[model samples]
Target: MVVEKNAPLQPCNTFGIAARAQTLVRVRSVDDLLAVLADPELAPAPKFVLGGGSNIILTGDVKPVVLKMEIKGLRLVEETPKAWIVEAGAGEVWHDAVAWTLAHGYPGLENLALIPGTVGASPVQNIGAYGVELQDRFESLDAIDLATGQSFSLDAAQCGFGYRDSVFKHAPSEAQDGSGLPRGMGLAGRAVITHVRFRLPKPWKPVLGYLDLERRRAEAGVEHPSAEQIFDWICDIRRAKLPDPAVVGNAGSFFKNPTVSPDQCADIIAREPKIVHYPMPDGSIKLAAGWLIDACGWKGKSIGKAGVYEKQALVLVNRGRGAESVTGGEVMTLAKAIQTSVYERFGIRLEPEPVVV
Candidate 1:
């Protein structure tokens, strides 16, 4: 493992923010990670882990040893008639995993295709798209405890997964009686996720939850498409709708589709009638933030070099003079403006989906 000082981070993060890490460590395996953690010279300094850097915004230079997880591999642990347990290294790209699953006929993750970031970072945010979340197929994950340098595993229930949160995202403040202080750990520092296991169904029917996909299936004169067809369609739709991050700088949906109470949705519906809402299992309604923002006329609006993408109201694009010129402050300004506009329009505040560092 080699530690570099003042490392340029613009290339690492998908946001294309020009920032530097005080110390950047690239570890290829578990032993490599432990070797750095055990170094006497680097003990007390703060540490932060960087996966694919697809879901984070670098505001400024980060202080600490930015440990970039480079561990990589994919293998099938167990397989049955219904499901297959597959393990992926933390450093493996999420899209690669989805592609591999689709190639092997695994069904659940096909809907989540084209999502950016690393497999290790998926469970931390419980990443969901096109009606599929990581928790839906998550078997368990092994994380290295930074303090003790020991490995631990967590099942779905123990992960404390919510809409877009997990125990790794939000750590406890104090010690609990029987619960043992909730570990006081989150996705950032205390625990570094090294590997993730997913239980994907092999012999399964397709999930046609999203309206657009359902419409496409109907257009093709097929009520139920096969898994491979659905996967291909999803990839096509994503490529059409979302800006390719490789060509443009983006972190998927900048803001999450805010969920409101059923009564609130009903009230809004009474006023606007045409406002669309998806009823959640808990009775809360998931209001489309894109529609709200478009109604407020924020789509394609630009501030400095950063602006909402003309094609996707939810995606904030970097169209400034140069990639390095774009700043987090500018992005935050635009996000806050959109949030304020939506609040004034419908009494709902929009929250960002990506982790803003």
Candidate 2:
């Protein structure tokens, strides 16, 4: 079990915020995690499981012991006439895994192309893009309970998946339930995902329902496009709208699109007249968060060292580089200001997508 103290974290997080971990452990495998749990000196300490660091904001030095997930593997676990069961290590780069599946002739993950973070974090946030979501293809996931060191497997139902939410994002309650894999039981900070399996259906269907994707398809003049084509197009679309973290640091889409009742949506529409909203299957209206932020005039605006991306107001970025980079404080301050403005104008509270710690 290798452990390092006062480890640098600027390179770990996509935000490029300067921060450090009080104690960091590189968990390359399940054995490494078990070893830490078995150690008397480390076992009792509080811990934080970190994956690709693509969806988090570091306010300052992390006090809890950091378990940097680095486990790696990718393979076809099983295949049936109906679907292909592919498994990936929790630490695997999500985009690379998506490309690998397409390269191996599996195609369902193409719509999720260019999404940042690891396989483990995908389920945690129920990451979605275009017209597809991780939960749509999730087969099951294996995780170890950090408190009890018990290994368990959960299907999509047990994950309690919602829009940008899951059991992993909730807080555990000792009195929530007393059973096996019950929904609504929180697992945040209590478990570590080690491997994730996806079930891609045998018959591949292109999800071109999204306006942007549909427009791209129409512009291309291709009646039937392959999965690879969709992947390349999504990558291109994201690149045009978002700033690469390696260049201008950001946690992609800092706010989740807020949902509202039809009446509420109508009220906002009556006022703004140009609010971007879509009717959900559940009869609710999902408003475009970027549109709201842009309406509030946040795009390209800076506060301290944090700024909203010029192309997409939903994303708050670190304008400074290296030592002069934006702190989490500045980012949250900007986010709060945006939230306040949007709420004051629209009567809807916007929720941030990234986890803050």
Model-by-model lDDT, in order? Answer: 0.83, 0.93
Q: Which ten residues in a row have the lowest lDDT in candidate 1?
A: 179-188
Using lDDT as the measure, which candidate wins?
2
TM-score leader: 2
TM-score of each: 0.95, 0.97
Which sections of candidate 1 miss by over 4 Å? 176-188, 321-324
Minimum summed lDDT over a 10-residue window in model 2 is located at: 174-183
Q: Model 2 segments beyond 4 Å from truth? A: 176-184
Error of model 2, residue 227, in angstroms? 0.6
lDDT of 2 by residue, 1-357 (tens): 679999999999999999999999999999999999998988999999889899999999999999999999999999899899999999999999999999999899999999999998999999999879899999999999887787889999999999999999898876634443333669998889999999999898888888888899999999899999999999999999999988999999999999999999998888889899999989999999999999999999999999999999999999999889999999999999999999898888999999999
lDDT of 1 by residue, 203-255 (tens): 77677878889878988998668777887888889888888877888888888
